[model samples]
Target: MQKPEIQQLLDKSFSDFTTFIGSLSDHRFIVSPEGKWSAGQQLDHLIRSAKPVNKALSMPRFFLRWFGKPAKASRSFEEIRDVYRDRLQHGAVSTRPYIPPVTEIGQRETLLKQFDQQKSKMIGLVGNWDEPELDRYQLPHPLLGKLTTREVLYFTIYHNYHHLHTLQLREKPEQPWPTQLERVIF
Candidate 1:
């Protein structure tokens, strides 16, 4: 069974994502600031990220244990999140297959539905696994090496928050002085 804490975290994360998407206007969903991905692409990326994880979660425990090696040690969510953040800060980019398509008009509803569906499947798959399974099974992260199944779930949680922050930054009005004006004044 999913530990109560993990379930709660999943619940909150899903709820937060749904609320965030619901609040966005269609134009805002597809509007990226400069070179960044739009909010819709970020949501699409989250959907893509969840698929392999859900598939991995569905594999038999025997299969996972047989193919995967033991994790070094179980790390807290914060540790895993910090390592992931550092990698991004240092220029780790999403693999080609994981990058979402350009956010076109009218795509928000479709993308949001996909995100919700994937998240629900993820929650269901993980919920079926007990604590022992969560800790015993390991998977290779693209950047973080081997991680217990629990840590993967933690990544899913924080990954949403990371993109949410990005989306929020894009949405913020440009209140700072214009670059040209600043240069002239200085």
Candidate 2:
């Protein structure tokens, strides 16, 4: 996606997620589903995940260049999504740094604010770069290795929705969630 489109999506996706998370009851927000993360933990995880990306984007171009450029062209959003999904299927999980601590109900509002700040900051940082610069620089993704800046944005956009889908499934167990790959709409 273009920079403007990516910024729009970054705004929309994080806004939707924080809105949903903010609406959760204290009990639901803190309670984990079996072995999965609680809603609050998910929120924390997202905040943790976005920090580095935001940091990377905020860096000087010379600093980012240290990571080098993509070996080939950037991948489409679908391709990145599919690769991520496949990795998850094969047992990939959050590395230690990204794992969130137990989140208390009292921390909900604070966490929500942090998420909003991170999202806003990220959107603003994205605005600093033009289209080709997005494809010209690279950053290391813990799970996906080095990705072009554009691909990083793509992954960030999809990652929000992926977590949103997971939270939705847990929130409404009685409702049948979509099962196929295409089900992760947006």
Candidate 3:
């Protein structure tokens, strides 16, 4: 797709994702039921993913050599699933599934706010860049392959949804929050 159109799509997706992330407020239930990291930790992981994303966006470009060819990378749910298993084996929770912690009661709101801010920066990064700029050079994705910057952004977009799906499964967030909440929370 053209750069402008892709940017527009990126903006819309970013808006939706921000809204979704903002809506998530089941901090009380994330880890209690599963003994995993709480919704806070899950969001931590999402914010963590952005660390690399920010580094990538700041890089000169990964597609410099790839004026042709696919110049991109793709990921599948199964691959991320395997990563989750590996993380479990190492004793650190993968944060693959989004479960809020029942323990750390103090950091939930701050953590979520951090995610919101970082997410906005990420959207800004994508908004200024486009598909064609992705054809500058190739970089190695942790699992996916050496690909252009654009492909990395593609992974970023899909990766957010992937975790969101995982969180949805973990949270089972069908019911609405209480009426007099402090956060108008998810």
TM-score of each: 0.87, 0.92, 0.60
* Candidate 1 local Cα displacement, residue 140, angstroms: 1.9
TM-score of 2: 0.92
Candidate 1: which stretches are off by over 4 Å?
A: 173-186
- Of candidate 1, the 10-residue stretch with the lowest lDDT total is 175-184
* Clash count per candidate: 1, 0, 15
lDDT of each: 0.78, 0.89, 0.55
lDDT of 3 by residue, 48-109 (tens): 77676766666555433433444334333345445544654677533433333343646666
List RMSD in Å for every model shown.
Answer: 4.0, 6.0, 7.6
Please give, for residues 89-178, the per-residue lDDT of candidate 2 as tens digits.
Answer: 999999999999999988998999999999999999999999999999999999999999999999999999999989988766554433
lDDT score, candidate 1, position 159: 85
Q: Candidate 3: how many backbone clashes?
A: 15
**lDDT: which is higher, 2 or 3?**
2
Q: Which model, 1 or 3, shows the larger lDDT?
A: 1
